[model samples]
Target: MIDYRKATVPVWTLATGDVRVPALAGDGPMTAERLAELRSVLAALADEPIATLEVHPLPEKLDSGRGIPLDAASPLAQHLSQLITQSARSSSTAAKATAAGEGLYRMVVPAKVAAQLGQGIVRPMAAKGAAGGIRGAFVNSTTGRIAAGATFVPAGQAAAAGAVGGAGATAGVAVGGSAALTVAAPLVLMAIAVGMSAHADSKRQQAIEHITELLEQLHEQKLEDEHSELDGCRDAIDKATAILLDQGKLGVSLGLDSAVHAINTALGAADRRLARWQSALDKLPDGEAVEIGTLTKSFPGVDDHGGTFRTHLELAALAIALKRRVNVLQAVEHAQSDPGNLFESFVRALKRDQQRLDELESSIAGVLERLSALELARPNGLRPVFTTGEVDRLMSAAHRIRKLGDGVSANSRTTDLAIEIARDKDGSVVVFPALPASA
Candidate 1:
């Protein structure tokens, strides 16, 4: 069994010249055959003629890879095409085609589920038609081939590079047929650039971009990391597509096993730090005074300032944050799944983790701010040094919790396959498409 906790697979884009690198996903290990299936889907991506910035179905190979059926007539395709057309008509064209990055990504499939499906099912599940909101837009489409995205470069950089030169020139010519058009050209270009930048920086795209970068770096430091050869890199050009698309069982659980391991490791560190911190506090004066002949002397103690109390509070907060992550994971694990609503369960799991991380992040930020506000007393001074190495470790622990928690949440959102949640009159949860949205 390939340890999913340590398994790394290749994901890349034509924009990166098809230079595939091992991307990390920590759900659990998979059979060697499953790994091969994932590779096949990635291999199919090289056939894309343009940079694909949205989720797309893995194309079935035809005629020895020289031909691919568009499948545009599929209901999934029609729905996606409509959404894309609407988005384009309502948004700026310049920002629509920017390259964020693209590559292979794993879906959150439980081992038992995989075992039941056996081999050859992976491609179908990955290629299965599904739909939901993506990057703040509605989408209904088939996905699971490869996680791909492309967003614009920074507007300023794009403008400087004259990336949209052709379109800009055409617009400029249509506006003024006179020589003064030259003078107005720069203003027109600048305006277009600003508009592109504004739309490209929308929260939807930013969130997606953030998730993409996180996945990119997830396995970068692993010793077994590998990348495709330069000769294998495919040519790419800017192509503006839809902002919304779907991936498979996408959520915090997508990297559940890896995240659990990370949280456990950090939890252990937090415990050790707390114990050491308490030990250091004990060595400090506890209001006792030493008598020297006719004089009474007492060393500076924790009672002299509020920093020690705050440090302790911060440690407790760190512990709480780590525990909260574990709790969320448990909640996901316990969520009922019996094949009927298994997919919906995954969506709910992602949403639950996302919501909890929001609150946990606020708590973590408060702890970090409090830690930063304290001024450590001189080590050689009489003041009790509550700032021990453990305090530093506590701060680091808090950061790790925040980073991992936030990344998991973002990953869930970015790769989420579908999000269909509603409440019936009785407050019973209802998932859409599979059931009526008003149910």
Candidate 2:
């Protein structure tokens, strides 16, 4: 449940003459000026394809007892409370919910789009259509015009229809009279308000604060996702390296002498890149850009300009690239012959790693496509800024690695490696490699 304010404005009134409500003025506690300001905000949201809305309460700031209160008896409020309770149960969610404002509003896009949009980029387009009709009704309801039962679309229904096309609505209600409008589906109105609220400078700052927290959450998530793959790659390298050395001790020279060297060289580059990324992250300013209420340490050491963050991001991507290259070296000697147990394991691991890399590559491409769409949607002067160089590099690297992974064939001759030390028909360094005949 949230603390509240009651609206002094008219709730339901007939429209008079040519006067039409501007569609953002829900009959809550919001003012006319705020509604007008929000119209501009919604206009900008024309291109944002928002998928969902997540509501978060600011319990610390709720002590002021301000803002329109959700109807506790309503299903919408109950559902929200349930979600908040669920979120509180999650340690990860609790760590990420550093919002110090009255409420933290979030646009939950599809997971694929979240890769870039969640990174504190420019505000998403406000739901302009969602705010339509509702505010116009509010303004007209006050003008004392009688249009003889010309029904004003209830605020909740109007918002739902305009915003999400009524996909998530559980029920609709109309509050009649001069008092505050008791919305049935408060979530719709809440989202509409949050969308429009960001145009103001102060609200925009709060949105950024919430976005910063989201960015940190993303960083943590990315690291967690990559941890297993990274460890697995390193273990595979160690295991394969030891195998090569043991083979040499037994005087079995399968022309794999260069494999270990290649693996080490590839790994060294990955380590250096990771080290540089960490150094860059450490060098960024740790101070809060602006303090809201008592929360001061939001987004510690996060690069607002996205340079260092991109470096952090690309390391994981680059790790995948490095792993793919290293796996090629593992495909030597018996890999194409009578596949020994060790070679079989390497092949399986390589296949699995390749599958994972393909998945990641697809996700990255999705992000890039969305970013490109965002660029094309906005005018040149209003384009959102991004450190796309790292992203582009990662994409290119992934493409090359994926191609190499595809080229690695179990059918390739034992004399040659499929992914490394081989050339394609065009004389490119890509065909299966032949193992040394001495083995």
Best by TM-score: 1
TM-score of 2: 0.21
Model 1, 347-387: lDDT tens digits are: 34434543433444344444344333333332244766546
Local accuracy by lDDT, each model = 0.26, 0.29
Q: Return the TM-score for each candidate structure.
A: 0.22, 0.21
Cα lDDT of model 1 overall?
0.26
lDDT of 2 at 219: 62
> What are the per-model C-alpha RMSD values against the true structure?
24.0, 28.5
lDDT of 1 at 125: 13
Model 2 score (lDDT): 0.29
RMSD (Cα, Å) of candidate 1? 24.0
